[model samples]
Target: MTSRLKRTLLALSLAISLPAGAANYSIGTGSQSGTYYPLGGMLAKVWSDNIENFNMRAEVTAASVENIIKVSSGQQLVGIAMGDSVASAIQGQAPFRKPLDVAVLFALYPNVVQFIVPADSSINTIADLKGKKISVGAPGSGTRVGSTAILEALGIHQGDFKAQSLNYTATTNALANGQIDAGVIIGSAGVGAITELALTRDIRILSFSQAELAKVHAALPAYSGMEIPAETYSKVTAFTAPAVWNVLVVKKDLDPALATQMLETAFGNMDKISKVIADAKNATVDNMDKLQGVPLHASSQAFLTKMKGQ
Candidate 1:
């Protein structure tokens, strides 16, 4: 065969073997016990089921910090991250060594800073946590960063507490088995582990006083004040806490059209997601601006603008 003909045949063979216009994507979400994984799974289902020639999968990761690293490195096509972490990733702040290029898709929900203790435990305030066994959060998780920052801001250094780095499920199990005195979980108001723990054992959700919250704002201005209603948990009444927006982000180089399509698909079926995870109901186009730090993906910004005009 002629050299040019052989080359043409090889190219044709390759094209024939590949699925035409097929795209495969992976979404990095938190551990299985957290809301991000389930919600991401739902989105993956939507994308796979609805978008022709598109295949997506949800990966259970170490949560926000890991998700950010994966998506920024292009190991994952998409990820859910805390607003502060997104900012931190871009600025090459603590927990991130070098600056990462990522773009925001939309703000999904608020990750409330939940300081939980046994209902009967005497740890009433952040100050009461001194010298106590506390699960700051798992290593490489955004919760860890926030927990450290908040504690340091309140003048409670790492040495002040018997710090245990555990994930949401592990934290819940540790607290319930009497292995830990307190745990900090930054997630949707009624995170799964907390709700499950409250079902069998009384749990106390600690609220930050206004002064404490002000200090949090100073330490991480990305966090905003949030309130968890009395009915959200079993034994806890209303509580005031700090929260940061949880945003969907993509690789900075992702195709704008695909980003916009993914946004529309996820938000369009949000009602389905909310039925399973109530926190997901908070996802809406109007709240897109809640995403700060990283700039919105160009396509997402254009989509939001188009939504606003309608």
Candidate 2:
């Protein structure tokens, strides 16, 4: 072969052997009906659009608990998990027997606990859920974890009510159809399922008094207080509820540079994200430090340090 031809062939061989770019990644999000699904789609779109050769997508799952398990087990590169679920997984608790090998990216927004009851139901308080049919979110969702904890915090046990394991859409359907007297939902303030139910069925969002809030705090310290605005649902005035932070998380072993890149890309375009999901507006660098229990990923920590110095 001629010297020029030989050199050209060698260059082609090397180029073929090199990777195209970062590996394609999947983010585990909640059911198609939940906020996480849409938000995850926007995040995936942003990353894929801005970064060269970035092949990323969002996979809908059971949310929180399942997302955490998937991310910790390397089944997913990242996911949206409730702060409380992250704490439990790290502490080797019920949902997770061992600590999850995951780290935080940032806090997304508050997962406000909404207890929706039919307008004519006699049930009025958290305690009144006893002996009633209630939907406490799907089994593997973070909503389920929070619902269970909040019930327990109020001294209500699993045996207290006829609990149905249904997703947000199912919960709303059941509530509206009178299949369930009450349904507990932990989601954004304007979750669609609840809103749709309100338009047809007179709905009431149960609230907690100061004393009830104290009891909840004693059991789950990660939760703080939040209120649902008066007009959020039909016939439901503003009321106090338990709130937990929703955080973005990734596998602990993710490449540091890649992890940092992911964080920067997501937060740098927060405005775009918020347009898709209103709750994402709360995702800020300042809120990143507010995450509890779960430690920040090494690269995430480094990125924050660099951000602070600027």
Candidate 3:
């Protein structure tokens, strides 16, 4: 063959052997402006940079439920799930029609359920929220599910309160503007949105007593035991509230090697990620095995095993 033709043929063969963009995998995150989306974007950037031949991307999904479904179907490679919700998704529990093959990449930080009442409001407890206007978080969010569950545990139904399906920003605004009596938020202990609201306006966290947690935990085994430490939020100087875990989930059948790399990347970058979100500072190798109810994927388990050994 002519020298030019031989060179052209060789280039074509090399190109054909290459797989798709190594740094181009999609992560299904939550609402456009929420923690999950930005967090996912951050992970995509970090992991894409750290891992070789595998880039990452992010998609705004309907938080937990939709993300799990999409991940299970392989529509999205990664998802951020509330621990309880992830467990339910794996077990095919409520809100999910059937059992799904969801696996944990690794555990993220806590998604604390904060019950907020006006600073001067008399609604100090969950029971007091009855007949009060409340923002129970955005539609299809983990907050919504947890709020609904919390209300149920407190023997308070949706109808009992003026349920507003608003996002954290909206909820903070609505509460500040007196549009709602209480706002139920599911986020990190040091959530930016929550802190911003607390700066000027005095707020107190509605502490969940043991009985309340008992009922909630009974129905949701996936929830991890948590406490909002004293001074964690200025709004609650010494608040002690129950919290839940968050999980990095994936399709059960995703390539194990890819999953391992992702999990390692997540935990390895724990400090950097924690800076992106307040609760994440606590994310470490120690927490990788603590998904509560959601089971870890084989690849993730293998990584955790190595992490533990090290």
TM-score of each: 0.91, 0.91, 0.86
lDDT per residue for candidate 2 within 60-179, as digits (tens), equals 899999999989888888899898999888887988989877889778888899998987889998889999999999989999999998899888999989999999999998888889
In candidate 2 the C-alpha lDDT for residue 281 amounts to 88
Looking at candidate 2, what is the lDDT of residue 13? 100
For every model shown, the clashing-pair count is 0, 0, 6
Error of 3 at 59 (Å): 2.9
Off by over 4 Å in 1: 1-21
Which scores higher on lDDT, 1 or 3? Answer: 1
Model 3 segments more than 4 A misplaced: 1-20, 32-34
Give me the candidate number with maximum lDDT. Answer: 1
Residue lDDT tens for model 1, 215-239: 9899898987887899688877899
lDDT of 1 at 146: 90
Q: Which candidate, 2 or 3, has the higher lDDT?
A: 2
User: Candidate 3 on 128-206: residue-level lDDT in tens?
Assistant: 8889888887776788887788777668987787888998888888889988898978877777787888887888888
Window of ten residues with lowest summed lDDT in model 3: 16-25
CA RMSD for every model?
A: 6.1, 6.8, 6.3
Note the Cα lDDT for every prediction shown: 0.89, 0.87, 0.78
